[model samples]
Target: MKKLFLLGILSLFLCVLVGNVALGEEEKISIAYIGASTDLPFWITLRNEARNQANELGVEFIDLTPPSMDAQAQKNSFDNAIQMGVSGIIVGAADSRAFDDSLDKASEVGIPVVAVDTGIDHPHIASLVQTDNLSSAKIAGQYILDHMTRPGKVLIIGGVLGHQTGDARKNGVTEVLEAAGVEVIFRAADWLPEKAYEVAQNELAANPDLTAVFAAWDPGAMSAKSVVAERGLTGKIIIVGFDGDPANLKAIKEGEILATIKQDNVKMGRDSISLLVDIINGKEVPKYIPIDGFIIDQSNVDEFLQ
Candidate 1:
């Protein structure tokens, strides 16, 4: 009986030693990318960059962006990521406050979340990696002030309602234009080019002498440019856009768009992944990570094109 008891004790000690060794070995972690609609160019680029970064870091990446920017759909994807037991989550929310409950649940489960491009007001968000959109728009508004000699009417086209990015950009433009004594006409396009075109057409009909236009997104800028061209007011109306998409940059080169604010979405994606990895590895990270944006216009358009 004494011999048997000693053998049992020895076996237990070996089991504990093995368990410690296993714990010391690096374990592969999986991260979920909960992006906005993949159809949107900005979100697509962001997602691709995050995926590439995850691959470089040797972490499993799962994409969960919905086909459209629906709040419920994004919530559902978040729930799925939680169920899959991902180590971290990177999100570009469709709506600012739509993912509060889901994010709270992630926190409860100890899954760290990093917001990219769009952010929520949840306490659990580990970091926000995005451009300073408001400041960029303010720069665009300043461009309008410098160019539009006359303080006449100007139109402001925006994306969907309640979209944090759109609202911030619009607020920035409004602040500068209103201060410069420019009459501004505002409209929300819901991120639809057709709606933006229609609104631009109607606004132009009512205010034919409009001096300039501030489009809060690239698509809206394209639509506004089309309207200006159709009305034979291309050179007369200065159209500025947010989101320096390639097409918008082309437009800028062609003089259709006077200028656009370039959001570093790719950097935002890579940074979000890097921060999430740090959080998962028990490293400290800031609550907010700001990425700078630049104004791309005729003077600097060639440099961007190259």
Candidate 2:
């Protein structure tokens, strides 16, 4: 009887040890991603890529974006995610300053935050993983300068105003055009294709001599291109947009869009998550990780199309 009792006690201890080991192995790090509206195909792809990377790393990823590009809505999402007790967060801030308090709250809760696509001006962020927006925009802007024949007016379609990435891109284009002695008219469309279309249509109607249009994203640029074509200005006006979406590549092939800067969005997502994991594990992480981008134009669209 004594031997049987001892055996039962030893088995219970072994089971408890094994259970703990399994639980440790199953431990998952949860991350929240606050992005732009998922309706845009670019953002949809970004979300999916992040999800795939999370799955590979055995991490939990939560996507949060406003129905529209509303700063308050994005802040609310961040607050909710913080309350959910996530280990980390990745955000493409809707407004650079709007999320300051929410980011502060997250930091207070001991959660690490990384900025993707757009960046926060606060110092509490763990790292920033984004494309070199200004440089990439300059590349597209130079393409427009070289391709357009006349010195006529040009329209600059910007993303959600004050969003870091969009702002940088707009500034880059503006800088290049201003230096090249071109007239640049500015417009803001909140990063919506329909909005971009509406704005472009109005601009075209008001200024028929508009020789070029630069968009900060592919959807916006594509919208502008459609409007330009509808107005029978297809070959007359040059259209340049950022983000190498597959549709944009096709447009370049069709000679509608002049060029687009291709961001390695999947790599951005994967690298951001990997950095967060390392930071959580007390590993060193760079303060800034600037992902490089490429320019896809008629000259190189064939290589990227396939």
> Which candidate leads the pack in lDDT?
1
State TM-scores per candidate.
Answer: 0.90, 0.90
List candidate 1 stretches off by more than 4 Å: 1-26
Every model: Cα RMSD to truth: 3.2, 2.7
Whole-model lDDT, candidate 2?
0.86
Instruction: Report the Cα lDDT for residue 172, model 1.
Output: 89
Per-residue lDDT of 122-156 in model 2, one digit per residue for the tens? Answer: 88898999999888888877878888898788899
Model 2 TM-score relative to the real fold: 0.90
lDDT: worst 10-residue window of model 1: 20-29
lDDT of 1 by residue, 164-246 (tens): 88898888888998997888888998777789999999999998778999988888899999999998988789999887888
Off by over 4 Å in 2: 1-26
Local lDDT at 196 for model 2: 95
